[model samples]
Target: MVIIKYYKGVESNLYNYKAMQAEIKNIDLELNELKNEYNGCSSISYEEKAAPTNKFNSSVENEMIDRRLKPEQLKIKKHKLEVQLQKIDNALETLSEDEMHLVELRYFKKLQFKVIAERIDRNEMYCVCLKSKIIKKLIPLIFLLDK
Candidate 1:
């Protein structure tokens, strides 16, 4: 068996794949909230002093620019969530059904190797080795999509 040393971030992403999925869903909700907030205008109005120079300045332009720029934090967060989601999704897609099932049993369901082996009609050692192989297979796919 080969021992693979993954970068900390990649390893975390792999082990926490389910958590990342949940986070992606949360990010989607947050993005929707931000969208609604951006679209819904405030009723209260405040007065602003005119620009000192003679340049034509309007509150409408400022409001437009603010609206465009204000969601940058959410946009960046959404983009990161997208990349993580894509990495996990693409990796999972590449797996065969049995391999996916093994992953579900181990990662998603958090089964012990003994339980997984019994469920799959395999020995505990075999299950452990298979999990290593599956993770090795997944690492490249995950990093490939990171780029």
Candidate 2:
């Protein structure tokens, strides 16, 4: 089925748009924090490189026994989060004003539908319906954009 696209300012609400933009900022902040943590652990200065490469196993094992297991796991987790953050940012960019607003309120802000409805002046049922439809549209867009 073909989806209809709305023109700029067409059935779009300003409050929703602003809400989304703000939520995007929060996601960005969170993404940056994750990246910073990842960098801290993965840094390689010349001094660090002075050690034998094989030292990694001993150092890592020591850290693990001291309750710092999974250095590699942290890297993988950071990578996954980066991918997820990119998808969310790209999806936010592609959304129409209306859909973007709905997604921001529901997912980004982590608001329940009833609360979103109250804020946006819509019925909760309608907000939930719109949210589901917007999510459906965004899912593949995110996947394609990430690829």
Candidate 3:
């Protein structure tokens, strides 16, 4: 579906809140993979040589520096992603349960309003009105451009 967004005063077309959450989720997944790699010690390992050697001998005997990220670096990255996810979670927590549910169906699940109404056992118009309310509530929390 087509989505439009305006940053500052210029008009740009894209979904914002959903994309933000999606990015956070992606970062979390990446962090998990990094953690698994650290735990498994699967990252490449190498020894450093103190002095230069003959090119052929060095190439044969000395492996290149691992160039792999240290586990500590992975931990730092994971911590940062977790902190960002926490911020997003805190912002989402401002909504009531019902409002949050509607948002999840509409944006997260990308469900149609009619389907959302059916799932919630509400009339279509009621669902639309509720969505409007939810947007108003979320504007301050998610849509910084709205300010």
Residue-pair clashes per candidate, as listed? 0, 0, 0
Per-residue error at 62 for model 2, in Å? 3.7
Lowest-lDDT window of 10 residues in candidate 2?
2-11
Give lDDT per model, in order: 0.72, 0.58, 0.57
In model 1, pairs of residues that clash are none
Candidate number with the higher TM-score (1 or 2): 1
Error of 3 at 42 (Å): 20
- Candidate 3: deviation at residue 60, Å? 13
- Runs in model 1 lying further than 4 Å from the true structure: 1-11, 35-70, 145-147
**Model 2 C-alpha lDDT per residue in residues 1-147, reported as the tens digit of each score:** 222232112224222445545555665666556545532233344545555665564433444453333434554565665665565577668778877778767755778888999988999999978866665566566555332
Q: Say which candidate scores most in lDDT.
A: 1
Q: The CA-based lDDT of model 3 is what? A: 0.57
Model 2 / residue 51 / CA error / Å = 29
Q: What tens digits encode model 1's per-residue C-alpha lDDT throughout 1-147?
A: 223455344446766877867776776787677667643444433554454666544566666776677567667876887787787788889888878888888877888989999999999999888777777777777776342
Q: lDDT tens digits, residues 41-144, model 3?
A: 23333543445655433332222222244445555765665564554466568878888898788767778889999999998899889877655554445445
* Candidate 2: residue 137 lDDT (0-100): 60
TM-score of each: 0.65, 0.47, 0.46
Give candidate 3 misplaced runs (Cα > 4 Å): 1-83, 143-147
Q: Candidate 1, TM-score vs. the true structure?
A: 0.65
lDDT for 136 (candidate 3):
52
